[model samples]
Target: MAYHSFLVEPISCHAWNKDRTQIAICPNNH
Candidate 1:
């Protein structure tokens, strides 16, 4: 899956918006 790296932070879990234009990421706190 080709994605824009600068847009999304390095995360283990994420969900794209309904339109697939934006994303919600769960940042790791470690």
Candidate 2:
């Protein structure tokens, strides 16, 4: 799940975010 953050940032494109349910569970979402 934490691995997904890598894609979340670049792909965000305008302060957007993908489902953070997984990110919230991640140990490195900080």
Candidate 3:
């Protein structure tokens, strides 16, 4: 799995499935 950061604030949280083919994410602000 991998992640990215923004210039202002944290954007979101994410995760990947066992095979690395699927992914899920949650917006940090919401």
- Candidate that would win on lDDT: 1
lDDT of each: 0.62, 0.43, 0.50
lDDT for model 1 comes to: 0.62
State TM-scores per candidate: 0.45, 0.22, 0.40
Off by over 4 Å in 3: 1-12, 27-30
Taking all chains together, the TM-score of candidate 1 against the true structure is 0.45
Instruction: Output the number of the TM-score-best candidate.
Output: 1
| Candidate 2: stretches off by over 4 Å | 11-30
Instruction: Give the candidates in order of lDDT, highest first.
Output: 1, 3, 2
Q: Write the per-residue lDDT of candidate 3 for residues 1-30, one digit (tens) a residue.
A: 243433233434545579856656565544
Pairwise TM-score winner, candidates 2 and 3: 3
The digit string of per-residue lDDT tens for model 1 on 1-30 reads 458673455555667779987767665622
